[model samples]
Target: MKSQRFLKFYQSESEKYHGLRYGGLYGKLFKTLHHEALSGFLVQADNSEPILEIACGTGHTTGLLVKEGFDVIACDLTPGMMQRVSEQTGDQHEKVSFVRMDAFKLPFPDACVSTVVSTRFLHLFPADEQELIITEMYRVLKPGGVVLVDFDSWVHRWCWALPFALYNLLRYQRLAPYSIYNRIGRTITMASRVGFSDIKVDGIGGAQLLLPALISGSTALKVGRMHRRSVLRLIADQFMVCGKKY
Candidate 1:
């Protein structure tokens, strides 16, 4: 039921997604921060195997991965999103392969890819489901493989919590916000249970992330400084949880 709703939502809005998330000056600002946050994790992925990206909405990240010369298997449940990736890939077809996939049931063989990345996607599910996602990611990843996932910060969402929960409860009948949090302890435990090692969270996009685009240039710069202090983790807009499957 929940899966169907997500599929329908993405399928319907695939074409509009890029413009909404990566459009205006604000969009561009967030996009650059997003890339910077995810780039380090990308390099952590071994080049011996192709990088697997799950729930790659509209290929915004796909374009980045390919541009950096990594062969990627970008997977999304929605065909519309996959089509957009196809279009976004343009002449760089050989660098990426599109796969229509249900993350719970990745089509590839066991221990196939060296790295599995899914960002801005896992926080939608509850604690149990988030573990399920980590478990599934563990399955397809090679031993010592890297897995990087981003979560929406609970502190950052506090002001909007009511509307966020109300909207989800009303629209899809689900308000699974377990992954939206200020600390990485629980997430570390969640991933560790599934045989992940060296788990930690990295702060990206500060609380001022919602500010106007004109101010974002300096705000993005602040992310590096913000990440150094653990206290600021509460206000960060997103947290990147990175670990290795061992």
Candidate 2:
């Protein structure tokens, strides 16, 4: 039932309340990760060509893309999210357009878009459905255009993995779910199957490391400055998988 809804169906309640709440807290942390993922594509973007953002929740990323002079078509499965995006942008924002649509089955014509970007949407799907989603993304992108997918990493859960599991069980008691796969690896492999080339993954934040860093005082911050890469590698909560449609 969950697989069917995620793959072939669109649910507003899932996209609105469940999706947005999770995004609100995790979104800020992954902005840096998104920037890194988008770096090359944003530089290459013509700004005049159409860009599509699937599952564009509150339009935070869409708004940023619009401000950068891109013609963005932002779509989500939820009407409430689309309305929220419109309200967030105000009526005067001409560069942005909103549509309500499912990610797994996009409504856009083939090869019509210069790029497709969807952030923080993969974990919602089981593995096979995730592959289907990537296939859909690849199908719509123009040749040489890129697909950028940002998702939570397995490494991030290391901080409080057991506790997080317990908390989810308690808070979402009625949901009846579990982590179905190692989302990070699954996303990478799925993108590869969809013919995405030049795939890359990177760490986002030092959230976990910060906990221990707090204990060491000035020495920790100093150590953080020198060994930033090491800290980021260990405490990465976000991962971006990017590739070009070939």
Candidate 3:
């Protein structure tokens, strides 16, 4: 279930969320890097069974999965977001379904899903809650099933730390770490505890490190295009961790 805090935020933001997400060059860059990472996992997944996408905000990734020929259950905690997803995807694909649910308590049977994909959602909670969500995702995976989830990282925190701190202070009257090294480190440990093996972590959005130089629209597009390069992906601002249940 979506926390009251996040639920309220998304409810208010849903109307403009799609525009804000795709309107700017930075947003496009982030989306490109994110989809690249997601596609890499989906292509390797066993698509014989349905896949579950938790926190499927606006169905951007869900649409991709449907196009990839996987039956997808796209779930989110907010009805506003789910509605937007329906608007975006329409009724064109019969392989897709939308549901409202909590990430920590997914309503699925054990070992039932072939692949689980979540993006841009896990960083919302603290460490303990994140572990609970991870355990739940692991619980629903069939043997040999693959789980792909994204995490915010402190790898390039120095670049935007001050600005984010100021923004949070103005918005919430509190300073909080938006990205942290321990978040990803502890997530890997939690996945191990959940009995997920063959774990692999890949860095993404390294092009974000070039944000300082993106003064013009052209520069931003150039930097965004660099996201596909191998070396830049190694020092990314976020990461996607893939684990297989044995």
Highest-TM-score candidate: 1
Q: Write the number of the candidate with greater lDDT, choosing between 2 and 3.
A: 3
Candidate 3 residue-wise lDDT, 92-154, digit = tens: 567778778888789888888879999878877777777889899989998889999887776
Query: Over 4 Å off in model 1, which ranges?
Result: 159-183, 223-230
Tens-digit lDDT string for candidate 1 (95-209): 8887887887788888988989887788768778888877889999989899988887767778667766885787557995324453466777878899999876777665355
Name the top lDDT candidate: 1
lDDT of each candidate versus the true structure: 0.76, 0.64, 0.75
Q: Which residue pairs of candidate 2 clash? A: none
Which candidate do you rate higher for lDDT, 1 or 2? Answer: 1
Q: Alpha carbon lDDT of residue 183, candidate 3?
A: 46
lDDT of 2 by residue, 174-227 (tens): 333434424556667778887988876555553554554457544444433332
Please report the TM-score between candidate 2 and the true structure.
0.75
Worst 10 residues of 1 by lDDT: 176-185
Q: Which ranges in model 2 have alpha carbons more than 4 Å from their true place?
A: 1-29, 32-41, 87-92, 169-171, 174-186, 209-231
